[model samples]
Target: MLSMHYIQKGLLFKKPPPPNNQKDFIDNLLENLKQSISLALFHFYPLSGRLVTRKTQDPPTYSVFVDCSNDNPGARFIYATLDATIYDILSPVDHPPVVESLFDLDRAINHDGHTMPLLSIQVTELVDGVFLGCSMNHCIGDGTSFWNFFNVWSEIFQAREKGRDAVVSHQPFHNRWFLEGCGPLINLPFKHHDEFTSRFEAPKLRERFFHFSAESIAKLKAKANEEANTNEISSFQSISAFLWRSVTRARGLAHDQKVSCKLAINNRPRIKPPLPKEYFGNSVDVVSTETTVGELLENDLGWAAWKVHTLVVNHDDTEVREMYEKWLESPIVYQLGRHFDPFSMVMSSSPRFNMYGNEFGMGKAVAVLSGYANKFNGNVTAYEGYEGGGSMVLAVSLLPDVMGALELDEDFMNVISVANFANMP
Candidate 1:
């Protein structure tokens, strides 16, 4: 009953040369990293555990749980070196290399069976910096949990370097029973097993990085609110609406074609008695808005933004709980792999993840990219840019043709900050 998807995140850190008094800086850093990871695992033991299924009923019904016993195999840690520099990746290139090439994917964690480690970290030493890639089983947690582990791990590393004991602000809660008790435990057999078998096929996709400056976001918000005739539209809604329209237009779908925009909404805040901020589990649900291509493109930007806003606003506590109950009735979730025709697009991650703040004593990350994002065409991941101000970096993946069209889109290019890409060395 393990989830078919593995959540993977990557962080790029600038490597500083060791002092004249110290030798082999990279080796010393790696040793300290290993120790820090060991200490961090003490607080996140489930990561070192295995996902095993236990019989829940007489007829072979089963439930999956993390086995963190002493004998359980520990999390996998891999180390490697790359000939290229970090700048080669951070620079704005017309056609960025596939993200997989930037990290050590050979040691990536996969959802194979009960014996597979729940977490795996691969550290690659690049010519100018380091790249850390973490893969966690999605069945155990979501992006929140993933970044929580990373931040804590970084805190431990920084504290260790300064000879101080790290103080954790929040501890993760691992009780899966709380969720099970709220609704029926329905197990839907995997119908698309073939999708899992071929998940790693080299995708015919091109990834691009788009920067939206604070001023541009402000303009988008203002335009959306003014067009919708309501000031209630959020920046996320506004930006998502703009992206939806831009991508739909880039794809050049039929006027009457049905198109959908899906967002991964975190339900923690919307739940009754809201789950603890440190609740380390999957608390996200997908909320989608569907409309005809003609309506979506012809309508005012506010109309699309309002549609996104309302779709999110309507999922109140009651609605979320109801959705949970329904999920329990048929607990099988399917993965929407690559979309070749581009009828829909999914926007995930958030600027709020604060990935740029993950400093491992080397300094803040120059860039952060999700190793597992954009597996499907038309996938968009938004993150706070390294520039600090309220700028945003969108990691977008689309078909080559659609991306070409988007690159030439005047309206879309007008709002994006060319300065960021222009200044790339």
Candidate 2:
């Protein structure tokens, strides 16, 4: 409903030629993302609309709009209109575009943790074009959803390029249906909610990037799987076990006591008719596990993997649907994630498949990033394989001490060394 502008003042890495074609790469990218989520697109409309000129009313959604319209197709954009440029990684192609450091949009938004907009974009070439950076509110979806939507949009865009129109109709999660299926749950005077909310204070969140060579990750996973004696384990599952063990150990080390870990439960399929993959919004459930520090540190990783597997498998449709219906009835369950405290920390692991280095005829990108920050003992971890198969990038945030301890553990760092990474590369 509003247009805002930010600037991109970096070298264009071989400036694109004059915009003589109907297909603008930048424009097409924005347009593709727009169509993935119908109403969500309104949150990032191009700069052709008017800038909100009022005193302001609505909580900031931490969303942004970016437009790259320039009058001089070949000229550099104004320095004042862009944010940052891509960071240089030890790879062959350019990484995600990074705006300038001076831009003011990098700060965390004050809105609900889920609704803060995270980026801003600007372009002077099109004169009238602007781009906005907005988010779907963190609680709605994590980077997986963002990347998945981008992947779907890429598919649609490629389809359009081939002169074929791809139409995808997404089915959103219906709270009413969930309610009807499992009766109310939000109002259950379960003492667990009150008890956990008081156990731990809110966590502090920090953002940073980590790189794990593809070689290292593969070898690590293979080694972990071999040690765990499980043929069905994946890199994500193995690494998640590693992190879980490490974090739980750290909590025990700090408090000299036992602790538990919580993993989110996304309940999309639990609903009747299940929501479609393309349903661009929040549709998830959560649950946790209690494990002792001694058990986590001394036991084989297979133990942790089974623990994670058990929680996921046990939370079937009936249990999850009833949980959803209860939440819908009370609307208070929405706040449960924010308030619960039984665990020392909560984590979510996203398996980044082959969607990272998608090429659009420009050499494949060197880096893809997720602006992840861990807050309230809640840390978000994502793993992605890079282009040409080099290292796996891990994006995470947590206390510096915890992060240091994690990397220092021989079991963890040995897998990330350049030599170890090169094995896979």
Candidate 3:
């Protein structure tokens, strides 16, 4: 029964919508959700599902599925014995949820008092209690894509319930078509590089939080850029370089370790006849910045940023493209590979992901996952302006103790303190 519960976190529009027939309202919401998923190559995985539990005095966030086979299908929904009350959560909110503007919703989600596990709903309404929640395969895509799928489904359902034609059509990307267009993955320069491995399970994993102000990062970048005489490097790149160098440094301090940084590269282009912006699905690849810690931190920020940028931008390198094409041509890429230990860490900067328009009635999400965690360990996701202004958040897997040790490093501290914002205490 636990396996049937697919978990996803989203906000409920506390502020009610216009009164309408209950059946029409739900159908409309479902229609919009379906249309969103149809926009991409997302139907392959059954990741979308819905439920409606009887309202309780306490707010709901987790759904428990009951029986699997019977006339009633699953047992009737019951409230979680222990949970937070709606009044307890809403007493601090500055304002009620909003509709129309996505930005307004974004602000609500990011507010200080708002807590994690912000909202949860039962999963038995759409399916029998026996079959609850939707199971989405991670390889199908990322969180942004998932959210888009849900939103469109809601829109389409709403229209249909209103006795209107369903205008949204699903036009997801075809994996085979994408592969044929990109050609085969052949002998690439980095073909020998190993795939990423996981480090620990949930219980064994650790979280380290880092806060930095924007002014400090700007100053550091100004100095580095002037000294290095590089024009294109930006502040975000400079900070990332520092973190990359820091991770490598940590690995070295552990004794001349061979560390590699996986940098995510968006593949909208660099291929002949660039892919259209609207073409969604997973069109991303990770290029490794493999280097011994001894070589990575030997120089200043400029050198580090340049190396990282070079690795990222050169996606079309004959060898690199060859390796990818060859991998896809193999049937294995289509099948899930064996789970292995993740040796390296994934690094991503989301300066704008949270800022995108997500308003849909309820106010914005207080926090969004940085997209770093997986079944593996050593995932790192950083956001410079998560809620705008200058506040920053770093989601990492390092233990708090090691993070404290990093605070003592002069170079690491300076990079975090100056390159972007002041380091959080």
Candidate 4:
């Protein structure tokens, strides 16, 4: 329940092919959306519930859980209209501030789930298209579970429009698999929730979406493996390594300054008697690696990629158990303000999720974007390119000057564009 703020992400659909009877069109769409979400909740009802935090006397700790009883306030639904067009959102190289308005519960920390709805849906109407924004509590589940809900919600929406039953191949598995103490009454190390669970503003920064074509990614992978003298590096590792160095160098950090890379590793398949793929809960484990800025910059792409590859590949069952056990000993909830070093970077989400497939009978989504909850400097969120086939779009958040430098950095820009690396300057 520590690291998850409401995951604010959604799809953009071009205004329903000529969008006739604008008023009726939007009214019907909103009606269907609310109904579809209600049906989806029947299966994923835990989302309709609220979080309950109480103080424990014997252990002098805190106990937190989801209250799924009649107290469940159900998911929140909102309807809004924008004076702008979809082009205003997608045309710019950098993310505009207006994008945040698409989703409800702005900057609401998950701890507010005690009274706030666990999930919020806002359908923002635009002249050129429509945006479906979903904000789900991170404390209840990780991205896997969240996306599953997204897909299912769309599935139900499609079925209702067709007047047919939704045929989902695999429904969400609500049973949580745990090797440690997770409970209706598990004790936390804190005496009050307010200590670490309050509101604060994130640093002002420039966030942009940088696209990498399939061919460019392959080059990065091949180059990393070749330079490292081994073929063990994966695409994610290579790209992360390349970007880490690129961003660090752009910032012009001191050579000896320490910087870190953190990524959320799904622990479902990593555990003994591995948990089911459809399990709907928090099975994510964050793993990190650190090195001096000089080492990262001076090292070959292959060397940096291999360093990350080793960190992810070698984390076996033993590591998972040990990490969990260690957390139980000294549990500390995070504060709202600056949570990491000025130079630390964390990459989340992936190019693997079926983000573009969310077609609610309106056609395929044209783009994907996130909310403003966790937008701190050095935070990077990734999504699959709308025109699939191994392409990637990384939404990078960095200080204003640093972002400008990265855009101008010739080496970085080469890998960013759609063209292959060989067509260099």
Top candidate, metric lDDT: 4
Tens digit per residue, CA lDDT, model 2, 27-76: 56455434433332323222122211112124322222222233312111
Residue-by-residue lDDT tens digits, candidate 4, 50-116: 9887775865767788889975778899998898877777766679999999999988888889889
Per-candidate Cα lDDT values, in order, are 0.75, 0.43, 0.42, 0.83
- C-alpha lDDT of residue 282 in model 4: 82
- Which regions of candidate 1 are displaced past 4 Å? 1-3, 18-23, 55-57, 92-95, 102-110, 177-202, 338-341, 372-374, 418-425
Candidate 2, superposed: residue stretches over 4 Å from native:
1-134, 138-145, 156-177, 181-208, 212-232, 250-256, 269-274, 326-330, 333-345, 352-354, 357-363, 372-378, 388-392, 417-425
Candidates 1 and 3, the one with greater lDDT: 1
Worst 10-residue lDDT window for candidate 1 reads 193-202
TM-score of each: 0.91, 0.60, 0.57, 0.95
Better of 2 and 4 by lDDT: 4
**Backbone clash count for every predicted candidate, in the order shown:** 0, 56, 53, 0
TM-score of 1: 0.91
Could you tell me how far off, in angstroms, the CA of residue 347 lies in candidate 3 after the best superposition?
1.2
In model 3, what lDDT does residue 381 have?
A: 61
Which is the better candidate, 1 or 3, if ranked by TM-score? 1
Q: RMSD to native for every prediction? A: 3.0, 10.0, 13.4, 3.4
